[model samples]
Target: MTLTQRQAAYEAEVLRRWQDQSDGAHDLGHLRRVWRNCQTIALAEGGADTEVLLAAAFFHDLVNLPKNHPERAQASRLSARAAVDWLATQGFPAEKLPAVEHAIAAHSFSAAIPPETTEARILQDADRLEALGALGIARMFYVAGAMGGALFDADDPLASHRPLDDRAFALDHIEVKLLPLVHAMQTTEGRRMAEEGADWLMSFRSRLLREIG
Candidate 1:
C-alpha cells in the first residue's frame, strides 16, 4: 500500500481502538484533540517529515492509564512496536524507523519519551497544547468529570494541599501544568503560541474564582 493508504488505515484503526476504550483520561476524544493540536504545530514548525509527525501524534498515548501508573506499560511499548513493524512493511524505509519510534516514544508526557528529534519535539508540543485554553478547560473537566466527584470539589493545591484527589490534581494543573506551558515549549513558535494560550487560561480561571467568591 502507499504511504497515504497506510496512514489512513492506521488512523482509522486507532480511532476504533480509542472508541473501544472506557478509559476516562486517555480516551479516543483525547487522541483526536491531541492529533489536531499536532497538526497545528507541524504546520507552524514545518521541515519535519509530515508522515512521521502525524503517526507520532496519532499514537502517542495509546496505553496511558492513570497518571500514577508506571512510566510505560510494557504493553504500550509493545503496541508501538507492533505499529512500527507494520509501518516498516508499508514502504516506511528502515532508516526512518528510529524517527518514527523517536516521535512515538517521545509523544507521551507519561512515558518520559524524550523528544530528541525535531519531529518528536513538535509532536510533544502538539500533545501539550491541547491541555490549555478553552480546549484545556473542557479537556480537564472531561477527565475530572470521568474520574469522579472529586474533580469538581477538588481545589487547587497551591492554595492548600487538601489530599489531592482527582479534584486537587485538576486544580494543581492550573498553576503547575497550564501556567508554565509557555516556558516548557521548546520552539520559539511553540512558546509564542503557549504564551497567548496561557494568558487565556489565567484570565478564564480568574473569572471562575471571582464568580465563586
Candidate 2:
C-alpha cells in the first residue's frame, strides 16, 4: 500500500521509536505485516476507515510493555494516548482522532476491549494474526528463550495430561493462546489467514511430538 507523504513520515517516525523499545517479534517488520493484513482485510471487509486502520497499525505497539508486566493490558490504552498526542503534533485530522485512538486501544488481547468500530475490529484481527503462523512459532521460541521458558514439557508436549502454562513453556502457548485467535478474528480474510496460520502451528506441534516420541 502506498502511504501518503504524511503517512510515510509517520511510519518512519514510528519505526525509529520502535527500534529502541520493541523486541524482535514486535519490530517494524511485524508492524508492516499487520499493515498489509489491515489492507487486505479492509478491502475484503469493506466500509472500514482505512486511514484510522493504517495509523493504528503504526501506533498499536508504540507503548509495548513486557509480556509479563503487571499492567500489560494497560499498554494499549497508553499507546492510544501517546499516538493521539503525537498525531496531534503532526497535524492529523481532528475529526478522526477518536477513531484512530479507538483502533489502537482495542487491538490488544490483554486489554479485553471489544472493538466497536470496523477499523478497530480489523486492526485487532490483523494484530492477532501475527500470533498464529510460522512467525508465531519463531516468536514463541524467541520470547521463550528471552524469558528462560522451557521449550516444552518433556513428558507432555501437547499439555494433554497437564495444565497448560505458557509462562513456563513456549510450546504450550499455541494451546493456551494462539489456537483461540482463530475464533476471535473479526474479518473473513483475517479468519482465513488465521486458520491457515493455525494449521502451520498445529503441523509443527505434531511434527515435534512425532520426532520426540
List, in order, the clash count of every candidate structure: 1, 0
1-213: candidate 2 lDDT, tens digit per residue: 346775687678887767767489788788889998999999999998777888999889888888888999899999999999998887778899999999999999989999999999999999998888888899999999888899999988888888999989999999889999999898889999999999999999999999989
Best by lDDT: 2
- Residue pairs clashing in model 2 are none
Residue 173 in model 2: lDDT? 94
TM-score of each: 0.80, 0.95
* C-alpha RMSD by candidate, in order: 3.2, 1.7
lDDT, model 2, position 111: 91
List per-prediction Cα lDDT, in the order shown. Answer: 0.67, 0.89
Over 1-213, each residue of candidate 1 has an lDDT whose tens digit, in order, gives 565676577678676655755665565666666666766776787778877766666666654555444644453465567567766776676777778777776666556655788887887777777777778787777666665534434244346645434454565567756777777786666777777788888898778777656
